[model samples]
Target: MDMASVQLLPDDVLADILRRLGPHDLAVSRCVCKPWCAVIDARRMLPADAHLLPLSLAGFFTVSWTESLTAYFSRPCASIVVGKLDYLDTDDARSLSVADQCNGLVLLHRPTLWPDDQRVLNPVTRQWAKLPPYPHLVSPCMKQDSYQREDMYLVFDPSVSPHYEVFLFHSVPYNCYEVDVVDEDAFDPAVKKMEWPPSSYTLRVYSSKTRQWETKPFIREGEAAGTIGDMESALSPGHCHAAYWQRALYVHQHDFVIRMTLSNEKYKVIKLPLGLDVRTDDEPEHYLGKSEKGVYCALLYGNNRLGVRIWFLDEICGKMDWLLKRDINLGNLLANYPWKHGDRSWTTQYVNDEIGRSMTPAGAKFESDYSTNDNVIVPEYTVSLLGFHPYREIIFFRTSFGRAMAYQFNSSEIVDTGYLQGKGPHDCVGGSFAYTPCRMGKLSNNM
Candidate 1:
């Protein structure tokens, strides 16, 4: 049909036609014109697992090391929502990286900028808020290696409130310089060292409501994970991950999950269960995200079989508990997408690149434990969890063989979306953030 004819169609007829299309197409159809956008928004045509009108999964923004690029992978129809971010005051777009994502907004950071500049962006609406500079915390114990290892997390939930918050948590060195007065003229500079996981945590938080930065202190609720001397590996880059759910922020640190209740200003350290601990040599791939039920921890185990175990957080009793909700063997799913001929997984990186070599998964550990089926030639594939669907019961992940798949928890259905971006997938997706297209109003300064 011609453009004029399509525009002439009644609103009811247009809504019916648009409803037949998938979520991707509906998002693209909204960009066609004001009439179509209005009809879709008014009729609530998009697929929303919770609230209507403004929330739906668009795609993901991934930061891959191999490509040295922060790329957006989404359906061709909904690609427009993933803007170029031209509004930022930057000549080159490559200077910015997606630090974190929350709901429909993404926190962009420019490490090259002095004092570290960050901006919160809404890709769908192209509205952004420039955050004030982060407050500085000077540690009395200054070591050369203590370059102030820090992490930033974005929290935004439209279902609850419109204002967004950014949390900054950093590590402090062990020893501090203290003065001891033996007499009025004689004084001694005594060195005092504090242990890791301090009794209280003072964090820097930025709120859009006030358009300013404030420090919030959280008291520790339990035993410490370990001492500062033992956290060399844990505090390294790319070893930490954070998630926001149920009005609180859960950060993965060392062998425990740091639960920070924003409303109560209390933090608790919940040690991982025996097998789920990250301190082991054979660390299973796990990710923290929210699904349909609530906060979920997805772990991929290669011990006996290539299986996935999902744990649900049960907080009804006012205690931190991880209840195993689903455990499924992925042997059948892997069988369908066999490795290509003459294709092999890269077991190790080059010797010169020590960091990449350490990050690479140990190939021998993933050996199939299928002794019962001796005749079956099982294939070994390295799988990584990308992110979870913010509203639905799905987990998005990628395989070494260049495949992007989503597993539905309720139905145990695995959908092979396609190749990761294109064919011949690169195993460089270091991190991924789920992007939900939200067309809310402008992010105003006042709440």
Candidate 2:
């Protein structure tokens, strides 16, 4: 057979060739011919089980006016959107907000308002269900003539099954902080005891399949000084984690940095690393963001830099390690550039620095606009610390600001990946983007 003959090539052979191409080349190849594009779309031109499909690593970031939910590929410069969540819709609502993402599923919560009010579990896919109300206290024991007792309490156990359960912490008249989980299958809110204080109560798990909360009772406590307080102070809506690793549902506590494993209606709490503080002095706020592959915690810090940190729980050590990092440094990059309108004062020292560097005035103008920290001109997208090449290790972000930027780290220098300026309309607040992996066979002709 002639080696150059296309008809002699086997389907697997062509796919192997396509699998090696980059995303851009693959995209262009789709336009070469319909049959070729179809073959590529069918993914038949690539290996059936190759792992280099340009997987994404994503997280959430915030700016002045709106919150940014972003995603990027594992290669430094390749990031595209899979979703965008708006913060305005969730403010002050009883909903848990986006807590965390694991294997494409998110854990949501809804707190109680009244005695009969129930909590909720909502998946990002929009599937939702209600949990039973937390257990409340009944009449305390004493002589029949004793003054009317007035103590009530409630507790919460997310590990509960058929319905995630919570218990009232105190008996009435006194507020309690302790909650315990007794059964993993059926979470009962009716049990009561006068001697059990709020601080000593632990949550119990109830399993849906087993139809009971738990067979064995267990109590998990945090290292923090006080008992779990109001849900807001104790938990950041989007910072918590509920994931499945090793065939078990693992709930990660943001406040205590603890991981609890739920298996066979039993609960076990595992402590994570010591120095991981989700809140930093700079941004002082948190948001949840997701990508095609995993979830990440977003924080804002000094110099108006947006930092994203991805967490992976280590089952053996019972801790989470931070990986897949990206940072946007807008302050320093925009400093000393001339304002677009030329109305703002420009420092002589800064002007001299720009002149001495031979940077053209137009370049300086664009830089100034791009880097400006105006409260009103929120960033639509940020340059990833990675780079722009989809095949290279890259991370990129898109914002309501109508821009897409890329970044990469090369030894000591953090450089721009690629940038698309003015791609957004004036009033758009939320938008999403996705990346399609490139296969090598498609690039053979272009390369």
Candidate 3:
């Protein structure tokens, strides 16, 4: 067959060949000719995970506001800064919190006393747009004697749809009344009793397509979600992450994981590991995450921050069963390991040279500068579980000392996997998230 005939291969046949290549190589194949480019764009137009087979972990970048560094780990063990967000290009007390990540887009807002500053950012292309906060009525200004609840989430998957959305699960309190009213009009003023159940949730959703804020009574009426925290606590950033997996918003609690469907606005509860008791005050922190393995809960145990017990969920005959995956020993890893702090700066000029987009990580340099935090080498250390390596079973987390590390479940190895905060004392709220890069054009299409 002539070269023209080969280039004119059927769409499916050509796609099959392209699928075998890595995302980077597959992207380059598009430059071969107009036919190949058409085939590539056609594939992206559809919203399927299969279409993204090449993007396994192609564009993973780290945004560390504490250090004002936005980078990605170059293979062996080091971080390379592609570029920093202008909004976060300062070293002030701007409380930037990563609310959620999906399809390479992240929802960032000030997790401070005022959370009104919100934006959806595409770190790869350095493109972002402002976002409107939830309606005022749903979150009243003045305090009242009633129950309140609020949950936030960022919903986006570039391949499936260009539309990006943010959900504000909020509810205001109302006066609770009892049947034992005096003369069927009022109850005793001296003794008062509030309602037993919590208040209903009002969902406020913002869509990039319409650029509008819309509110609706939660579809599951009468179902009350408990208050996450109080006002003062809310002002301080908390790790109340709402993970988007399998097109559902998943939130973890002590007893169950709430799987709220995005399509029909319905919710279902998936119980946690049987007989698992988790508390914040004096107990291990419980965090939920999704991976190729499945939905799993990481129970951080040991008063000395010694171990993390991971449990992956399994289903047997429609019954949810929990199976322990691995119990990672931090003490073993940190017992006598040498800790080094190195400068996390690298070449990013070539990053945008090709496509004018993010760069492929050439890995980071871990040259010992002896400038790392001494606290990170302390005997006792705590950690906050982040997400995972896009394609591997490795888990990512930040130590109390502000260094991010990864635990390879299958390999039984540990390595410095990320950078979001360095010495000083961001402590832990510097905020870190794992994401794969999607094109910036997707956002513009939605607009």
RMSD of each: 11.2, 16.0, 9.9
So what's the TM-score on candidate 3?
A: 0.64
TM-score for candidate 1, residues paired by index: 0.70
Expressed as tens digits, the lDDT of each residue in 1-447 for candidate 3 is: 334786678877866765676544555565466666556656753433233422344323344444333344333222213343444433332344456666667776665433677778776566677776667543433233333445567877543456788887542222222123112212232212321112333567888888879975444423333332221121112344556665677665333466667777776555555334433443455666666555666666666546687777674574556788887778888665555434542212211112223332222222122224542455656776766655457777766654556788888887664343332334344334556656532454224
* Better structure of 2 and 3 per TM-score: 3
Which is the winner by lDDT between candidate 1 and candidate 3? 1
Q: Residue 15's C-alpha lDDT in candidate 3? A: 60
TM values, all candidates: 0.70, 0.36, 0.64
Residue 414 of model 3, lDDT score: 78
Q: Residue 77: error of model 2 in Å? A: 17
Assess each prediction's global lDDT (C-alpha) against the native.
0.62, 0.31, 0.52
* Candidate 1, 1-447: lDDT as tens digits: 545786789976866776676545565565566666656666673344122234467777776655434656564345343545556666655567787888778887764313377888887666787788897774334443335556788888665666789998775321221123111121112312244577788889998888889998899888777655444344232535677876889887655678899888998887655353333445566677777667778776665326677888888878779988778777776675432211232211221121222212233222223212422324555677778887788988776644567788889887655445321233556677877776542365222
lDDT value, candidate 2, whole model: 0.31
Residue 53 C-alpha lDDT in model 1: 30
Q: Best candidate, TM-score-wise?
A: 1
Judged by lDDT, which candidate is best? 1
Separately for all candidates shown, the number of backbone clashes (residues 3 or more apart, or on different chains) is 0, 81, 3
Worst 10 residues of 2 by lDDT: 345-354
Candidate 1 Cα deviation (angstroms), residue 220: 2.0
lDDT of 3 at 61: 38
Model 1, position 367, has a per-residue lDDT of 22
